[model samples]
Target: MDFGFGPEDEELRGRARAWLTEHLAGPYADIRGLGGPGSEHEAVAPRRAWERELGRGGWIGQGWEAEGYGNRRLSLTGQVVWAEEYAALRAPARVGHIGENLLAPTLIAYGSPEQRDRFLPAIARGEELWCQGYSEPGAGSDLAGVRTAAVREPRGGAAGLLRVTGQKIWTSLAREADWCFVLARTEAGSRRHRGLSFLLVRMDQPGRVEVRPIRQMSGTSEFNEVFFDGAVAEEVVGGEGNGWTVAMGLLALERGVSTLVQQIGFAAELERVLASYAASHTAPGAEDAVLRDRLVQQWAQLRTMRWNALRTLGASPDPGAPSVAKLLWGGWHRRLGELAVAVRGAAASAGPADWAPGTPYENGLDEAQRLFLFTRADTIYGGSDEIQRNIIAERVLGLPKESR
Candidate 1:
């Protein structure tokens, strides 16, 4: 299959590259590499401003087919080109991705026209940031087990506010988000995936909504615990009692151009690791044959991943494609983290000599240390290896369901 970009796509790529070069200046220059995966805690205020800048450039919601959302409708390849250029420039990690990528797509697909009008323009303008409120204390990968509940008040008829009361854990960017799309149960006696509703709730409810940062091993608190106590949810996408379908649709959209963008970032990381290995000639184990082979294998595997991603992009809806992509990159990243530390030998184990006990986590360690620590959760987040395999088995392979 020919995955190369056509003439029009090449033009799009050039335009994207030029736009990034022109805009990433003055106030946005220093923020080039800030707010990525492990470094989300860096430059919080500046990164939010950067999101607005991207919106101004019409760079946020490029894939949507709709008109007049402050976004330029682009082909899938055009979206991929923009993503590649954006990653190559090391632009500040997007604070509005959940809204632009996940929630906006979901709303376009399943939301009422009113819902889209109310939310999509703000997302496109980068005026409102969003966080996902799907995972909870007990329902990380097993999304069907979400227990958050939303109840409607009797006085306001069908348009009455749904009062949400529950907790969500591991919510990325919750601290900076202006809104959250919550998956909550609306029926009194429903279980598992039944009677669920996808609710859009505002994050600034003062006493009703609370966000507490969860400090990770990397010493950054990008993820947070969100409490919605009688929080107001005025809109439900795909109607009430149909959240499971809407949520699954949103997950399916995850395997789009974003995956290619991720591969570009991974390639850059691999280049840095290779550069480190080249400089570590005198470091112990750096000369080891096994370590050398692992580095080569990492490069080869990353290439294979890119090809696989390109080959499958825009293909028919394969139930296992998303899970397969998750498994591939998740394990590959964890191993790369291990290799990043391994190539550095003994020096990788120690923090800076002047580091004090009370210092902040970001100041205490270097990039490799942070990468190693943060990638520890790579396989666990999004979806665990076990869950991915089970999805492939049951959904794609026609295997029997696991004994529950």
Candidate 2:
């Protein structure tokens, strides 16, 4: 496959590099504040600020159509360049990820005029934040097994609320979210995939809702466990019993564009790690050599991932492509952490005090250690590595599905 960018792509990359080099400066480079492990709790101001910055610069949601972008759209290559440059600058993760990656496209595909008007512009400008309420305790990976019920209200507008009741686990950024795109059963006694509906819910109001952050290895609830014991659902889009498609669509977004950008950011973190390691080269040994070699391979892998994503974007949004990218990143990140642990040696015991650039700042080392510790589950979340293998085998290679 010719993974090379065309002339226009090259030009776009150059412009993106120049823009980031100029704009990404001063206070943004600290790495931790942009939703990394050590960020302080801000109500919603941080997300708003970052969104406004990206929106003002026309950098958020690169794939937004011309009409969506006031009569012009970013080319696919341009978006790839933006992802690269954004990561290169260590800009905060787009706080509007749920809006940008998950909901916006779905709305474009299926949302009614009111839904579009209500949600799109705000997401584009980062005015309102969103979260996904997808995974349930019983259906984390077994998506079809979702038991969250969204019963249709009787004698009411179909625009009527779907009484949503179920738990959503691993909900990222639940605490400050303004809205949720949730999946639940609508028709009783329907099959697993049938009767499911995708509902948009406003989290601000309450009707039997609970949210408790689930602590990660980072020692923070970067994600949350959300429970709804008869929470009200906002307007339902994509209709009842067709939620499987919308939910799958959302997962498709996660696997594709968003996954690609996240990998780029993680690669940047690896770059930071290498820079620190190179600066701190001492007590030369074979272990160091091995780690360096692995780091070099990782750099190559990240580039490969970018090129793969570019190719996918240039063509169609293939579901398999994102899973492959996610699988690759899942392993690569863990390796970075593992090598960092070896690099840190005893200093990891003391935590962040051990990871100071090349000098082994205690904090950097501590963070690296945490990254390593946490990355083990990387392969399991989203969809497990095994599940991805099954997808690639059956769908890509035309092999039979694995027998349950």
Candidate 3:
């Protein structure tokens, strides 16, 4: 398949690069590389403002097909070009990515017209932010093991609400999110994936909801533990008891364009590692032939990943594609993190002392240390390596189910 871009795509790339360059100036210039993955706690206020800037420029939700919902209808190639340019420009990490890339598309695909009208506009405006409430305490990888329950509470003046009560673990951007799209067990005696409902819950409802940031070894609180106690959700997406279907559909949409967009950021990280290697004069592996070979391999593998992702775009619906992509990038990133630290030799083993006088301990991890520690959970958090292999075996290869 020809992966070459046409003149139109080049023009779109130019426009996106220009817009990003023009906006990432003045006060916003300091936050150009802030807020991503483990570093999400950095420059929160500026990043939030950046979201609104993106909204004004009509840069959010370029892939959505609905009229008047997005700024303009962009082809898949155009979307890729825009994503590449945005990452290349070192734009502040998007606070609206979950809403724009995940929830909005799911809503457009399965939500009611009322739901779409109410939600899409707010998301497009970047006025509202969203977090996913899928992973529960016991259901990190096995989504079907979700036990967060929601019960209908009939109201006198309105169509009843679903009262949710459970704890969600490792929720990204939960504290900053204005809303959360949750999957909860709505039917009594439901097993596994059945009898679940996708409910939209307000995150700031006083005592009903709580978000506690989970501090990582990287010393950043990007993930959170969100507790829902009698929380209310009036919007049950795709109807109650149909959540398994809706949730699975949303998972399918999570791949494709989003995965490719992620690779652009990965490329930036790779470039940083290479720069570090070049700057080090006396580092242990600076001249090691084997380490040098691995460095070259990392570049080659990233290129291969980009091509693989491009080939998978708009391809036939393969049940295993998302899992495969996850498996590939998860391992690749973790290895890159290791290479990042290894290239610095023994100096990477010890971190700096805590600069703050009142801090608890002396250990202070820099960006490379943080990257090494954070990527350790990449394969574990999303879906475990075991889970991805199981998916490929049973669904794609037609192998027998594992004994559970």
Candidate 4:
């Protein structure tokens, strides 16, 4: 397949870059590269505002059609162009990506007309932000092992309100999100992937819902522990007892254009690591041939990943693709983090000491330090490497299943 962007794609990229340059001013100017994977906790309010700014510029839903939601229905190549430009411009990390990328597409595919009408507009406007409530206390990678229960209830004129009760861990942006789409067990006596339903729950309920921030080694609390005690879910996306199907579909959507955007950010991080290595005077290990070779290999693997993602952008769902992507990027990022700290030589171990008394700044690590710490969990969260390998072996390779 031809990988080159045509003239139209170039024009779209130019427009996106120009818009970002124009609008990334005032209070938003300082937050250019502020928010990202390990740094989501930085500049929260400003980043949320940036999401709304993106919506105002019609940059939120680049792949959706203009007919129903008034979105610009760009080609897959155009979407890549926009994503690449967005990353290159060092725009603030998107707070609305869960809603725009995962939930919105799934809704468009499986949601009722009313569901789409109710949700898509607010998402398109970036007026509401959403977080995912998939992983439970027991179920981080094995989503089929979800145990959060949602009991149906009737509230006033509403016919099918759900009282969801359970705990979800590793929920990104749970504290700041206005809503959450949760995967929970809806049927009694159900096991594994059965009896589950995808419920859209509001987070503003005072006593019903609780969100406890999960502070990371990176000195951020972007991930959270969300508790639901009789929490109310207004709508179910793909109907009750079909949450496995719906959840799987949403996971599939996760591997789309955003993967490329992520790679661009990864490239930026890699650039920083290279710059650090160039500037550091710490011994000669920074100039080690093995480390230098690994750096080149990282660059080559990243380029391969970008091409693979582009080639598979519009292809039909392959269960292996997502898992492979996860494995590749997870390991690559974790390695990059390791290389980042190692490049600093002896100084990587300790942070700047706090000389003043009565102050709470002791372990204040810099960006590279944080990246090294945070990426330690890269292969564990979302889906572990072991779990991903199992998926590829069993589902893709048609191998025998491993005993539980």
How do the predictions measure up, each by TM-score? 0.96, 0.86, 0.95, 0.95
Provide the clash count, candidate 2: 14
Best first by TM-score, ranked: 1, 3, 4, 2
lDDT of 4 by residue, 1-404 (tens): 46888999999988988998999898999999887777778888989988888778877777764356846778888888888888888888889999999999999888999999998888988889999999988888888998899887745434666799999999888888999999999898899999999899999999999999886655577789999999988899888889899999889889778888899999999999988877874676546887788889888999999988887775677889999999999999999999998887778887667525443222477777888888999999888999999999999999999998
lDDT of 2 at 312: 73
Please give the range of 10 consecutive residues that has the lowest summed lDDT in model 4.
354-363
Cα lDDT of model 1 by residue, 11-129, tens digit: 98889899999999999899888887888888989889888888888888998868888898888777778888888998888888899889999999999999999999999988999
TM-score of candidate 2 to 2 decimals: 0.86
Which candidate ranks first by lDDT, i.e. highest? 1
- Candidate 3, residue 346: CA error in Å? 0.5
Tens digit of per-residue lDDT, candidate 3, span 1-404: 45888999999888888888999999899998888888888888889888988888898888896878756678889988988888888888988889988899999989999999999988888889999999988898899999999987766323566799998999998988999999999998999978999999999999999999887766678899999999998699998899999998888888879998888999999898888888885666448788778999999999998888888885777889899999999999999999989877788887575456545221477667778888999889878999999999998999999997
Q: Rate the local accuracy (lDDT) of all candidates.
A: 0.89, 0.72, 0.87, 0.86
| Candidate 4 lDDT | 0.86
State the displacement of the C-alpha of residue 383, model 3, in Å, after optimal TM-score superposition. 1.0
* lDDT digits (tens) for residues 165-221 of candidate 2: 889998877887888888888888887788888898888766567888886545555
User: How far is each candidate from the true structure, as Cα RMSD in Å?
Assistant: 1.7, 4.4, 2.2, 2.4
Clashes of each: 0, 14, 0, 0
User: Positional deviation of 43 in candidate 4, in angstroms?
Assistant: 1.2
In candidate 1, position 51 carries an lDDT of 86
